[model samples]
Target: MDLDLAAVRAFVAVADDRYFGDAAAGLGISQQAVSKRVAKLEADLGTALLRRTPNGAEPTEDGASFLVQARALIALADQAVDLVRSRHRALRVGVLGTRIASAETVRAFHETVPDVGVEMLRSEGLADALTALARGTIDAFFGRALGDLGGIEARPVYLEPVHVLVGRGHPFAALDGVPIADLAGRSLWVPGAVRPETEWADFYRVLAAEFGVRVDTTGPNFGVDDLVERTAASPELITGVGEKIRVPWHRGVVQIPVVEPSPCYPWSLLWHPRNRHPVLPELVAFTREGFRPYRPGRDWIPEPDRPAFTA
Candidate 1:
């Protein structure tokens, strides 16, 4: 309905006092505002909420029914606050990956408080996080560095520069940073390589198109095991993944930095509009502070950290 809290509160006061001037005095507002609100509320609901009689004012049957709802709304609002105060010890959270964040600090904070319960979950990637976010299964997620996140209604927490992953014995593997051209003629193991171009895929193609680089991409993009196998077999093959994926086996695989005008992927903390948890507001603020980027903050990251992308 078009009814507002102000109007509802005014209506309640008027119902209790039964006198416009007295109700106005109790609410600390002018009687005209009270009258106008009543009229607007009635117009919005298409039913008169109050009737003028010789004895001040009285609520009609419809008004009485609405009064019940209004009072219930107010009571529930009060009850919601009470619930927060009483039951905040249990908070369920989803983390994109166990390795994706400064989870230790987050856990420590929750532990210190003793009044909050923090739970975490793992996700496949950004898409997984978004799916969980849409379903209300998880409260937050972190993902790889590409995409414009501005319009997604999320607040970013941290970002690290993108890195290239290649097997250790590969010729270019030992390099501190490889030129974008270094990847030009390589048999690239790219994710979503075999799939038709998506708008999101187009974003990844910017480098290939702009640098006149040709890549041989074929296979599922999500498998790290496959990338490792391809790298072990082909010196020309390489795949890109998030910076957070630490190279576990130094003997076979290594992550070399991308030095020539590289891009950074940001991991974000996103919450739903309806996710109004008791400890969430505090947790989000702390997480933002904890994961805050370096000196330049958002601007410090390498080229084309354009924004977090969503499809």
Candidate 2:
């Protein structure tokens, strides 16, 4: 049934002031208007909310009970309005891989959304982040779009060419860019812990297949430093990393570009279309303004062609 908030407000005002004229004055309306609104409320509720007293008016038994609920409703409404207007416009976003961000992007986000308090949630991989997004655990996600995102809305933020991390003393370290074919005889180490699902692992596996390379996976407890330390210790093992990521300069670890049909990692912002966060669109807009068309080099394609599924 349709409940009129205006009538409820009028009834609450009458109940508070105990007089139609006083209630009308408080509401800045005529006494006749206040009486009509209260009557309408009573008619709709099928109960008498107020009764005429000798001096002015008084609430009936039912009106006294509903008076509390009416004030509570108005209080809740006020709270909601205050929440939207105050600094509580917070957004929870999932960030994948290393949590490193460019200085410019950070500055832009703060400038564009000065009032929005952003809470960055970390996940191990894109699939995990996207899962959090789908489950309503996060308002948005920042990372590579693994494959077909069935229900999520994705927007590309930047395109980063994949880089190979190798030991400084390795044979490929002297080269400017390692060709994809050069990985044929090399072993690529990937972290196996908490990756959300097999799709991400499958993408790398497909890359290994298309280029005739050996894909090796490690433990269920691997981390960023662990992967780097392991790669630095083994000259025969190398790993893939995003060029934009700022890995701490290890004594023996070096990062090199991967070229010859260079596999580009496309970073995107993913959000559910029905998200309720008021600041989510503002954040997405801020991110888009920062990266607009971020393809740093030549031979830029929208996505990686090797994975086949991501294309």
Top TM-score prediction, candidate number: 2
How high is the CA lDDT of each candidate model?
Answer: 0.63, 0.72
lDDT of 2 by residue, 33-117 (tens): 9888988989999999889988777888998899899999988887677556533556777765433553234445867667668
Q: Could you tell me which 10 consecutive residues in candidate 2 have the lowest summed lDDT?
A: 302-311
RMSD of each: 12.2, 10.2
The Cα RMSD in angstroms, rounded to one decimal, for candidate 2 relative to the true structure is 10.2
Candidate 2 TM-score, true structure as reference = 0.61
Give me the runs in candidate 2 sitting further than 4 Å from their true place.
1-87, 98-108, 111-115, 124-131, 146-150, 192-199, 290-311
Top lDDT model: 2
